[model samples]
Target: MDLDDHGLTFSADAVMDETEELRNPFPSPPSHYTKYTTHNLDLLALYNERLPDRRNESQAQILADQTDVPDWPLTQLEKPRIDWILEEPEPYYDVFGERWFVKDKIPSLGEGGGTQLYPEDPTVDRRPALLGILRSLLVTYSQLTSAILAPPPSINLSPANTEPPKPEWEEKVEWITVLAQNLMAAANDLRPVQARGNLELMMQRQLQLRREETKALHDKCDILDAKLNELRAAAQLISSRGDSTDVAMSDPTPTKVVPDDVLAEDVLRWAEEVE
Candidate 1:
């Protein structure tokens, strides 16, 4: 049987042509084609499925809905929040662990041998100020507390030294430390008062700025109104004058009646330039 006649055989030239046509031009796939082709396409399909429809809403709206927005994002937005924090701030000593205080380096006193007063008043004696006294007490209290808490020195001695030390010394030192801490707490408490005062001052300044801006806006509005009125009067004058032969003869050129919008635009531009 003839293989070609039975459709089971091909010519040698035809086979070569078919092989060349079907041959891969590249040894390996192109970078872009292979880049993510191996990655699971189902991941993207799943992500698209999970995403919310945002046809009616904008991407910004969608993201905003998803994200937490601060109540006071800007300083201007928090203008009226001075008395907002009604609850008295909890003392730092109460909030923080005593270990933090213990680990913290003791804050140094005023410069110049740590005895310099707040004011260098020549008339007043070189006595320590109230702040200085508090600072000194705090330092002394902390030192005493540290020393009291220290482990007793190692020694091989008499039975008298073997007794566990009494708690009386620790109790007294703790009391003194508490007093110093209270004094320091009071000093810290005064800072909020100053902050509140500063806030009030800022509020007043903001109010003043707003008032000035309002006044400027009102003045601009008045000027625009005056200009609009002038334009209207001019238009009326031109219309009335159109009926008169003498006026028509005196000026052959008819005055262009500027549109209200055009006149307003010019006025606004002038106002902006002046500002």
Candidate 2:
């Protein structure tokens, strides 16, 4: 048998020999070639046998009759609660034990610094409690780290032995360091710099307003000075006119009245007082 894209074929002589054998309907003694060929052909026959047969119109109608068969409705699963501890792999290993699901552990800083065990039983779900603890730890760490990283106090201190800070303190310190780095980066952002610049600009504007006010006051002073000078000039003119009137009214004699210098001094003093 020869296999090709067109299908299986046999030479005319081979077919004739096979036909004579088939007409006798007797099994031939198996040779190596026959055995191998038979095995391959058997596999092909089995493969074809396993394939689904093409549906005829009658078979299709039979299937159509079963189309109205009711399908079983799907059921929904109940959702688990928040506290339920879903199984998770152990985070750490023990010297002698098979790996198994375990409760989560968090390092604690207390009177006795050690790891705090949190129960992970599904019935006792303590995620919220654990989260609260973690939050508190974070806050404590922030404060401690800030203190540690803060610049030294202005006053000098004597060296002395001090109790070691908690592990949470160290964690806080690390957190603050990272926070400071982030803050520094954020400070470099254009928005913050622009805000600073805007504040400076506002200060500049205020200064300019002050300067303008000062200039305005100076201008007003100049106007006041001009008025003072005009008043003084008017006072001098009145004194000169009074002297002429006294001269015209006198009997061409030396009539002694208060000295003009004294009167002028009195007038100038009055002007100064008024100013």
Candidate 3:
């Protein structure tokens, strides 16, 4: 049968025999007659002219190009075809008017009846990474608390010694501070649009406040250390003078301990706010 009689035409010089019926995944609808042709329809040239890489291409032009020349390497040959047959052929296009051409009949995992143990994007579910970071941070904070409860290291409070007393909580504080900072960064990176309600900003602000609090604690500890040093020096001077009178040294100022309860409360508040 003449392919033209059926309103369909293709190159007789194609690798496939023209006598055999051509395979058309997108068969024209019976109700809507389609006159497929390739005359003067340089699909590549038309695509280059109309659908530029970074230009406003019309939807009609893109769909026409995709339907005519689906493959790029094989689109060089101008095979037999026609022009417009139906007012609107069934085709899908993106918001940018780019046509979505079908290359294969492979069904997606959703419809193929198969289990996708892993998603295409590993970070699609960031809960695992976020949870791991949070757990590490919690453990670090717990260590800081324990270190605070632990006895301060022995120090020689001598004016001549010139050894500045380091606070026991300082190391632990730094660890927790670094961990908290990392957690905040990770949280921000993994923030989903659906769950976002200034949550990333809140986390950033909270981390900043935590750093400020830590700095204040460090300052307080320094002041206490200075006072303790002065008292020790006074006692030493009195003893050197061979004074029989007892030189009573004043008690060192207490350092503020960061409570884990406060941290827990803040986390709970964030959760509630998000909810």
Candidate 4:
């Protein structure tokens, strides 16, 4: 579908995205039904709006000078949310993470540490974050209700060993090693499953091929056996004719010769025996 047909052109969005200014340089966005439907309100209560010291002046004087607006303030959207989130946010840039162990390792820019990472106020170590997300998901999605249905808490079965605590760096290295080993073990476990499937497929294909070959050979043998039976019947018929002719030649009178009807009867008996 053409954009013109649907009245859904993206030229404005493309221009706004490329502009990258505090205010969009492109034409004002076309008004939509949402603009009319929204109930916008301004909730700004800045310190600058505070009345001059109440303790230093009389109540009447403060009342006379009061300029506070009542009820709903105004549309805060007029204040521009992008300016609040990203644009010209110089006053609060000094804030930093709780800990940045790799600060020095990060390559220096022209002025300061390389760059501020996204949501750059806290160091979220991978293990804790992952575990927190996992725990939250487990709690939120678990359908089991009864304690009897719940899995038993795991307990260590190995004998306790008294060993000195390792340094932080060594502990980090151990964590990394364990993570790598876990990944490798998972991969190894999956490898055998895939190999077993592939091997089974190949074996089944070969077995099917052998079965087809065996069936073909059996069919050919049946055909050859049928032909051999036919040849044996023909040979028996020719031998009967030869014997009858010999007997007729040995007879003293022509009357001793076998009649055509008797010969046909003998041939029919031989055919029945072959069947």
**116-167: candidate 4 lDDT, tens digit per residue:** 2222222443345345544543443343233335556544444574554444
Model 1 reaches what TM-score against the true structure? 0.30
Error of 1 at 26 (Å): 80
Rank ordering of all candidates by TM-score, starting from the highest: 1, 4, 2, 3
> Which candidate number has the best lDDT?
3
**Model 2 Cα shift for residue 44 (angstroms):** 97
| Cα deviation of 275, candidate 4, in Å | 59
* lDDT tens digits, residue span 129-150, model 3: 5577578768877877888888
Question: Model 3, poorest ten-residue lDDT window?
Answer: 27-36
Whichever of 3 and 4 has more lDDT, that candidate is: 3
- Cα lDDT tens digits, model 1, 134-189, are 66667767776777788775556577777665554566575565555545544553
Question: TM-score for all predictions?
Answer: 0.30, 0.24, 0.23, 0.26
- Best of the two (1, 3) by lDDT: 3
Candidate 3: segments with Cα more than 4 A from true spot: 1-128, 157-162, 195-275
- The parts of candidate 2 lying over 4 Å away from their true place are 1-188, 253-275
lDDT of each: 0.53, 0.53, 0.56, 0.49
Segments of candidate 1 deviating more than 4 angstroms = 1-130, 137-152, 164-180, 188-199, 245-275
lDDT of 2 by residue, 105-216 (tens): 4322221342333442425654565566556657867688677777654543456735443444566666655544433333333365599899999999999999999999
Largest TM-score belongs to which candidate?
1
The lDDT, on a scale of 0 to 1, for candidate 1 is 0.53
User: Candidate 4: misplaced stretches above 4 Å?
Assistant: 1-189, 254-275
